[model samples]
Target: MEKPKEKPIIELKNVLKKYDDKTVLQNVNLVINKGEFVTLLGPSGSGKTTILRLIGGFEWTTRGEILFNGLDIKDLSPHMRDVSTIFQDYALFPHLSVENNIKYGLRLKRINLPRESIKPSIYKKQKNLQKKWAKEAKDAMKKLDKIQAEYEKELTKKKLPKNKLVKIQQWLDDSDFKYASWEVWPSLMNEKFEKKYLTRKITNDEMDKIVKDVIKLVNLEGHEKKSIDQLSGGQKQRVALARSIVIEPSLLLLDEPLSALDAKIREQMQQFLSDIQKKLGITFIFVTHDREEALRLSDKIAIMRDGVIEQYGTPKEIYDYPVNKWIANFIGDSNIFEGKIIDNDEEIISILDQKIKYWSKYKFGQNEVVDVLIRPEDIEIKKSKGLIKGIVETIVYQGSYYMIEVKHKQYKILVESASEFEIGQKVYLDWTITSMHLMTQEKEKNKNKDTVSLNLKLNKEEISNE
Candidate 1:
């Protein structure tokens, strides 16, 4: 027999949501497939949350249809939609115990039946159910451990040639695992080590264990049972995630979930979220105002402005080939210059600046105003080795990277470098023509329009060697 075909869990068709006299969402169309995790990312007032609210049935769309599994759900109440939403703040009931708070959704279903007619307290049933799931999780963890050991043994079994072993040892050394000096690897190791170590640390029947296990896919283990008041901002956010995933919803919606966390925690959460999404294969829609987070977490991202999708594609496409200027700047730091395009060759472009020419894949007509976007990381920073020389204005350390701001010819541009360059020191900025992102010259003319593209003009062929 042929397998049954799966349908999209949520489909938004030409959705337009507007407040009186203001349109928050415009012709919004999206399809969320079953088990797919998608994120909606944009700045404040960009209508990220509006989409979430519409999906959740908290608000009605001015125009369009919302379908769930081929059935129109536009008029369904929030509770009728099988989807679940996780807010940044833990919206647990203060009067209820942790376990009860979690089962509130299930309890709400029971309210219609005679309260006394129910066979068992929801807590009692939930406890038993939790115990059953706990046992299953424990067994799964053990299986994971066995698999890991088998792999490790296989790695050790290869009585490799002396040189091969030496090479492997060098590789481990370079990875710093050899120097880690821990009895067991960090919880971040494969599922096997995690199961073996964490299982030993907590009871299988522990509610905390269930929460921890859900977050384990996100690389967060331990620290369960800690009150929300005692946790760090990031930890609290992860706790919220743990709580949400513990129930395993088929559709998960995250709206700027990590916005309040510190930078360190945010980075950790980013990786964790990616790992969890892959492991669960559940449909996840994340809404965020952070471009970097969107780029990092999304398989395909849609850039939204004023409730409309400006552009949508893979991160590389959005970053390397933005259709307009606002999108280019929104995705990453860019240096933009405006000048008329005087030459067009499929692989090269000439700007009217006379001093600057670029090599790119996109072509524009002569006299066409064009925009150029060059990422800070793409520009070469060095002493006495660039097309333009400028005095260092500022240097900021960003953990693994350094950002240097340089002023040249009254124009200040930021450049990223691994090695630190001193303030007041003269530095040259050199960028290859291939690094340029070219856009249509009509940006300025369309500037007054919502979502206008900016024009960037490049000057100088190459930095001279001193």
Candidate 2:
């Protein structure tokens, strides 16, 4: 048997958020395992950034639990949470030099919290756990989970009563100790002792070492003395990243950090960020509206729409098997249509005299209408003998390759070809059976706005005179 998958470093369970009367996010569920590069991708106002804020503890869910290392962290504050976010606007201290900014979080002194203000719900046991019971408590918390999982499986097999199920759930939620708080001085004489104990700061040598190492990590070793104003946009972005990562947070959130950079620099930073994530083995939750950027950088992508995750999977899965027409159009240039499947075999699929062939992953009845999507690059254009002949409408010279638009009476197809083809030139467009993606016909009927599907419906009568 295969080994079980490790638990997520951070998890959002049915998270929902509301701003005044507006529900920004509803029933959001996401899991990010350790060291995984996951991206939340969507257009603006789609709530992708809101998800990052939730993970960073800058925003809280209106309902549902946020878990860190299997423990519920619904009550954790921004500083208390072990997460760092790099926003679009670097958020660096204007007066600090790059070296000081990178070392800022690491050299921070202890946060002075009054003992009474720290509630049980907002506390971590590490701050106050007794020395003798600390190890035992930690082991128990970790070990009990696996044991409970096994027991739950057995219970499911036995089909236990509802009351027994409740009992098991209660046992799982039970904790040996609750709340974490700062200790107060018992008497006037002990006040100085409390200040000494509570006030903690890193050594000068340690801060120096961390700043030096992180500066090197971000490829800004020599430029450590430079202020924010002295650095370029990309350099400033690097400094922001170094600051977030130097403290070694379990999860790193990047909210469109590359948005301000030019295309070339953005590409460079993309590779740099990905390489760093791999080298450090830290989980990255990147947020971006640029579909290509998400596809290029993320190991897994969660596509959001109007505060909900429309689909979540690998890039290949999302590309080859889009769950809907909207997703098919968003990621790439696709030719989507409601086509009729005529036949299964060679030329037997001929209708009237047009032997058009389309590939489908699912088996549908002959003569059944279905929704199909095929990428422009997937289709090959041939000057001579090809699958379907069409009149070239236009040719776009795209640096590396030519994009030729072909019109076949009612059908318009886009093909990425190596060679250039002139306007009104006759060409053949072809694709392998696997290149076509199919969706439900009923869903296609629901499309009110024909976006990608519009390229095919131009008036042939209007073009006849031309």
Candidate 3:
């Protein structure tokens, strides 16, 4: 058996950042592996920048240690660390040429090595390596073609027809005979693929390969000659990313890098950022206040409020399993009920007024008061055949979805669906027991957690009763 790998390139241990009376980050812990793109997602004022600053040495941590290559970097200054930060403003010197701007960080360090001295060697080596890989990939493709043609002929000529075997062979060929993968595949099958898989170590060449690929991946392929002002906001952002990644920092910190671009540009940039992260295998800690952006781009998301991280997990986890009522409503649209846990049966739970039954591996005692959260998308709205009935308070026609509000007894349940409904019309609202999400916590009366629904009907009568 092969041995396990070493620790990550950068690790933040019990990190905390404070400003005057307020604490920005509270015992933050994260590990950024070599060539791993891990995005840090949260809203504004969530200390997302503070974590970046701590890693970049722009700000000092009040408590924890920042480690680089498994050594303490708490005392290292920004220049000392190999990390380079790309700020939202581009922060490029207007007077300097594009070439000079790229080399600015190196210049500030005042390394004994001259630009002329290193440029030829570095670029020559990179060009030669690219040529070598291009030839190898070309050769591999030729070999694969010959092998595949031979197999295809053999398969066609065989008297014993193998339907299952044919399909399996097709699968192997489709997979490039394990030569390349959708991402990465088994090490044993491809020697070139496994060349970088050393135990407890990550090669600098591996980092360089990703860095070079990201430059192309982000579509900044020919902008090496363009000046800062000459490029548009989207182009500038891509260059900023190229600058940040050239050194192959263990942690890549992005602070709302796409906010300045137009909607179309933003979408395009988002795809580039997402794709580059995957291809480079870099840990990206992306900070954004946009809910849609966070939902679309993040692998794991941390929804934050004020200076606190309200919830943290994979995008699906946070969207599905919110810790509390605030979090449930924050990340997405949720229909919440401020009620008590009445029955608390072995598997199911009953909320006040609404008896919702769900299978739970977790056990709770009877008579436990809790808040029940149901996502707007989870609740189904039909014109007929629903248990809880109400008059449609409102009907909103969104391009792709519908918002529905149904008044039931004392509460108004909001439902989101692809179906359309009319306002002031009567409708029925119901949900499967499994659709109910319960939160065993106290509720805040004034805070209305129900987001917009497709069709809804509510007025004085519904408000007075509650």
Candidate 4:
């Protein structure tokens, strides 16, 4: 049975962006499925950030549509759209404590309190319960506020342990106070509180619950009272993440959030972010120039170049079967061979005047020039009994393996091996025919050009004749 298609949470259709006659993005089309970690990957000037900003409503598209949850949201403002963004710099308020910083968005958020009709007797019972506990609840709140302020002051001097903070949070959890605030206690104790209460903003209790939950989610429990300046780069990033997620946005946009960190910290944060996204199950659209980073974190990657998406696919598909030479080279190291099909039946090909037999799923026309790519790791180095022989030009040690560059008559091949080889040594290179991947050339102005798909169809007919 076929699996059901996942719903698309965001879509960009023929999206174009320009700046004063300079086109930044051109005819971009993309679909991000719900809860998928999608990355927009490219070097600078590829307009990766422009696509992010357009979807975020920071910049309007020149021509096309942006959809969220199947509805067009091209004109919605950043705050109006149910989206949150974590910028490259951790945008936290230095003056505010970590907990306050996380609560910043929650404080500004407005939510309509739900109203429900109830029996008069039940309503009176609820009101009586509120009146009985009102004074004790107010006292509990005052004491909680005092303790929190004192904790913040203590954090400035020295960092406290997680157990100490947990004790304070435990007190709140154990209390019987369920009302939002003491100031609104009387309003909540009235009849309207049970029937048609219309408070439109998040109450203190709601804000505290949300902030606490997000802080715990990001593992920032003990550091919640520390000011922004007191934290490390990774901690600051976590604070920014907690702040954005506290409001529970439908989607999260991360714009190179880890670029500024040190190598070790960046790697650790990559795993941290991946774990967090999976835990929350939120659709994350991350942007980065690092190919390895994109490959590691993204469920789907869109590789952009010169204001257009050159290719978009899973990391394995893009790495193993790149659509063109540029993408193959940009993605990873590969040895490219430019050759022509010299014979059709025997699958003989000519590369640099040397005839070799190749195997491919798609058939090649006679004398047709094509590009073949073989990854460096796919080629094996042998002392004898191989398809081609070469002289080792350079050998570099890469901790776990050695990268050996070999020079043939007119081609330079790279081979990664566990065994070290000396320079100037003769080496035989061999690989299975199935390891070779044929690349499709970019289309030209001719509308009737034959592509790989057409060649595959023609090949199927020839096989039927046998």
Q: Best TM-score goes to which candidate?
A: 4
Quantify all predictions' global Cα lDDT against the true fold. 0.68, 0.77, 0.67, 0.83
Candidate 4 lDDT over residue span 386-446, tens digit each: 8889999999988999989999998899899999889999999988877888765555623
Greater-lDDT candidate between 2 and 3: 2
**Candidates by TM-score, descending order:** 4, 2, 3, 1
Q: How far is candidate 2 from the true structure (C-alpha RMSD, Å)?
A: 11.3
lDDT of 2 by residue, 1-466 (tens): 8945866888889998999988889899988888899999988998998988877777778888777766566545444467888999999987899998888877643434566765554345323434325555456556766777776786766678889787877765652222211111122123333435444466788778877988899999789888889999999999999999988887899999999999999999999999999999889999898999999999899999888888899988888888888888887788876766678543123321355765655677777666678788899888888777899998889899988889987877888888877999888877876787776654433234585356445555458757
Report the lDDT tens digits of candidate 1 across residue range 1-466: 9845656899999998889978889899988778665777677888988888888777878888777666566534344466777786656454544333443443322113344654465546555655665565566656655755554564686576777667655554443222221212221232232233222332335544454455564444554344455556776666566566665667778878888888887898888878877787767888888888888888777788878887877788898888888888888888776656655543334432335667666556766767877789998999877778889999999999889899887677889999988999988888887787787643333325443322111112222322
lDDT of 3 by residue, 146-178 (tens): 777766667666474588567748755565423
Residue 226 miss distance in model 1 (angstroms): 7.2
- Residue 457, model 2: lDDT of 56
**TM-score-best of 1 and 4:** 4
lDDT of 4: 0.83
lDDT at 406, model 3: 77
CA lDDT for candidate 2: 0.77
| Ordering by lDDT | 4, 2, 1, 3
Tell me which of candidates 1 and 2 scores higher on lDDT. Answer: 2
TM-score of each: 0.65, 0.73, 0.67, 0.75
